[model samples]
Target: MLYGLIICTITVIIMSTVNIGLEFGKLDTEVFLIILKSFPIILIIAMLLEVLVIGRIAEKLVHTFSDNTDGFNAKILFTIFFTVIGMSLIMTVIGGMLGKGISPDSFGSLSHWPRNFSIALFCELLIAQPPARFVMKKLHLRQEDKLDYDFD
Candidate 1:
């Protein structure tokens, strides 16, 4: 919990710093306000993307794995790859498009989108393991082949 707080605080500072030169006062205020107020919306959108977009897509792709071939570890790797790279790229394109018409004074803060998206992707990755297990189990992945999660 303490670590999460520290990380969140640091992220906010980094975001503020990134916006320092890109936008002016009014635009900064507006964009910051929008970010603050609309954060829940963004989070909801990301959640939906995880469920409606990534989850379904991963389900389809994961089915190709044979228990004798691709297993838990492999699926996790592919899911992470597809989720982070694919979603981040999609968000980047969308952000770029949105950036075209309007110049928010704080629009410069968008430099953090990728970073934020990465963080969100990581969170999604963590949540993904349970579903991954379910899928792997359904595929008849055995316990003996499981990778030992050694912290050392």
Candidate 2:
């Protein structure tokens, strides 16, 4: 979170400086204020959607598939990961189609392969079989509770 904030601040500062230098102060200030005003709305909409839709759906699915009686926790987690990947792919495509259709050249450069690769690497390193079980034991956590860590 700290890193994200620092990057955002740096980006805003750089963009502001560029705008002031390229355009006049008046135009730059106007655009900056508009962005600032719109940011809160964007954040609120995202948060509300996540809380109302994403959170509820994920919670229901996880609980519905939980290994309460039988010992089939893996099936639940497997479903969760696949669901996440499927949703990510769909969102990427939909987001690519917002105001205007995605430009082929730009979309080619910004495709999701790099992100998927990083996520795969992290999963492999942190949660691949015995290593994960061992880590959980060390942390004094159960496998079911470990699902919570996946989100973190």
In candidate 2 the C-alpha lDDT for residue 151 amounts to: 72
| Per-residue lDDT of 15 in model 1 | 35
lDDT of 2 by residue, 1-152 (tens): 23223322333333323323333445566766655654444344334443456445766676676656645666545544544444334333433343136776435423754464344334433434344445556656666578788878
**Lowest summed-lDDT stretch of 10 residues in model 1?**
1-10
- Name the runs in model 1 displaced over 4 angstroms: 1-34, 65-68, 97-152
User: What's model 1's TM-score?
Assistant: 0.43
Tell me each candidate's TM-score: 0.43, 0.32
Which stretches in model 2 have alpha-carbon errors above 4 Å?
Answer: 1-45, 69-83, 86-90, 99-152
- Scored by CA lDDT, what does every candidate get? 0.50, 0.44
Question: For candidate 1, what is the lDDT?
Answer: 0.50
TM-score of 2: 0.32
Candidate 2 contains a number of clashing pairs equal to 0
